[model samples]
Target: MTCREASEYLQELMDTTLAPDLERRLRAHLDTCSACAGELTLQREIRRRVAAGVPRQEVPSALRQKVREILAPREKWAWGFLPRPVIRWGMAVAALVLISLIPLTLLQQNREERIASIVIEAVNDHRSFAMRVNLPTLPTADREQVRELVEAKVGFQIVPPMGQRGELRLVGGDVTYFLDRKVACILYGKGSKLVTLLVLRDEGIEATEQGFRQVNGLRVYTATYKGTGVVLWKQDNLLYSLVSELPQEELLGVAKEMAKI
Candidate 1:
């Protein structure tokens, strides 16, 4: 391969995603191409620095306490002696209040923990899908369909990365169950770069004004998937997130697209 080709392939090589033959060719080109070698060295250094600088912080005790309070039942009354109508009305009101508070409580507890769980699941999904990258039997469209299938099967949606329609294309997606939650991951590729979007079940998120937050050193901006932004609220027992690595503007656009879906 030419020097430019090899240089472009270096990103995949760093991620260990390139085919063996192509990787060898790229390495040979790098051996003789000073510019490419220098570029790879710089990329490696940046990756190393990023890895060394970002340490995972533990969830704060205050947050944990708050979460417990939110998730913990406020009052438990024995209803065995109550009349049917009285018990039904009381139970319904209690359920409504509990449903309303759970998401708020979870948010108060630790948003970072929620985000970390999702990110880890996404990374695992990416690793699994990478195995099919070079499989001749897997068509590109089929890869994308596979991801969508997993999302459907797992009862979640996958947000395609930005610029996918015109520039980057859907590569694949995977479903992973982690922390007793289901996460759907959709992978997109632009040239040689790949980005994955992870969506966790929305049973635990609270309904509140949309906002932005960062976790695990990654910037996480939240908004509703279709309308204004995601309502940090809970429904049933799931927490929902429409997440992506696409820039904020593009992610917002994609969220709008998701609303249509």
Candidate 2:
């Protein structure tokens, strides 16, 4: 979809009401276009700030009566042919949906806030490698040495995936802890694009409702967090989350390929 069309549907996209095909194209466009990504981020931030500033108050009975009176004539004209009971039921369902959105929106905000912090930490750690901070335990391409180092540090046997060996070369790896559990944060590079593959135990991590998808017997969670695309999944008892600037589809393709190893 063109950028103009994308802008037109941005509200629906935020509400998660767009058709699946359209939503896919929109996300694809956002992935490669930094300008659009920034615009989306700005819009979301504005919404969050506005929501935070807004006061929460129950609708007054007089105001509700006025709104119903204003819509009564239009509803009567629009649904003149429909049965009264059917119209009443339709209005009830619409009210139910409106009422439920309040809590659902809050729940979504909390989930995104929590996940965003984790994603930001991962992204920052990925960037820290360039600064030569918290250097990897093993720097060679020897699989045996890397595996031994990872296992010894994290207490879990890990076979770091060889990502496009030459194109996306694995530079080195080190162990890090998340929520007290061992995590093997492996670093890989492809020209300017740096990828960090996190391997850890999935004991307490919760899969997001909208972010969860399945691929080749694995449960995948995909999200664009803090301007970075993250692909997370579980294999056996191990959880893996890959963080990068790659598009969602491209990231998923790379992830699936890596899972083969």
Candidate 3:
């Protein structure tokens, strides 16, 4: 399997949900890739912590007392109505099964909530940054020159759109953090319009065609964001969003151009 496919299935492998053949493929990849191996180790640690930390519920005192009473012997004639030993054993087994399911159900709920929290935190951070910054000044040089300067100074390779001559004019940019991940936000302008392009390590969101999502009135576009006549695409696992009060069509045109790049 390819590295990307292996990476995608790593979580399933950790959860022991993958079919044996697929699991073997992923394991083989992990054995060779140090990065994937480290990721697997971290995932295993997280699973262990989650399992260890989730508190198991104890049987309620009232229920325990009731069970004891039911199991106790009685000399009264009414005892003749009691269940046979086999029926009693079946009921006990059913009760145990039901009780055992409670913890697993709670654990599933907790795991889902934890994942949701992480995604929400990432989206919120993006939204918060959008609200705080001002647009930067337009670049004085050509797009290629600006890209070269950015690469030299910022250490990130910036590729401009195809068939476009300096469509996005570089403005100021900043480095920021969200949820322990470092991010770089570059301000750019197309003509008189201004926008923000964020280069993040990763937002932890799955890649999909439904890339644009709005959170708390902040319009976030993943892989690409368009504003005015400029489009931005995320390159190198970094997220890029053009935050501008521009027309959607123009933004889409810019996105198409960037996709070629």
Candidate that scores best on lDDT? 2
Which regions in candidate 1 have their CA more than 4 angstroms from the true location?
1-108, 119-139, 156-165, 207-210, 213-261
lDDT of 2 by residue, 7-120 (tens): 877888888899999999999999888888888888999998998999999999999989998978576586689998998999999999988896776456565454555566
- The TM-scores, one per candidate, come to 0.36, 0.51, 0.35
Candidate numbers sorted by TM-score from highest down? 2, 1, 3
Kindly indicate the candidate among 1 and 3 with the higher TM-score: 1
lDDT tens readout by residue for model 3, 1-261? 787898889888877899999998888888889988898789889989999999999999999988877887553336566668966787799999998997786456553343333344434433444455432232333556545544554455665433265577655545555434554555556776655554545445334124445433333453322212223344466555444555766655555544434
lDDT of 1 by residue, 133-186 (tens): 533222344555665566676775443434435664666655557655666555
Question: Please, what is the whole-model Cα lDDT of each candidate in the order they appear?
Answer: 0.57, 0.76, 0.56
Candidate 1: count of backbone clashes, pairs at least 3 residues apart or interchain: 22
Worst window of 10 by summed lDDT in candidate 3: 222-231
lDDT for residue 166 in candidate 1, whole number 0-100:
61
Candidate 2 lDDT for residue 15: 89
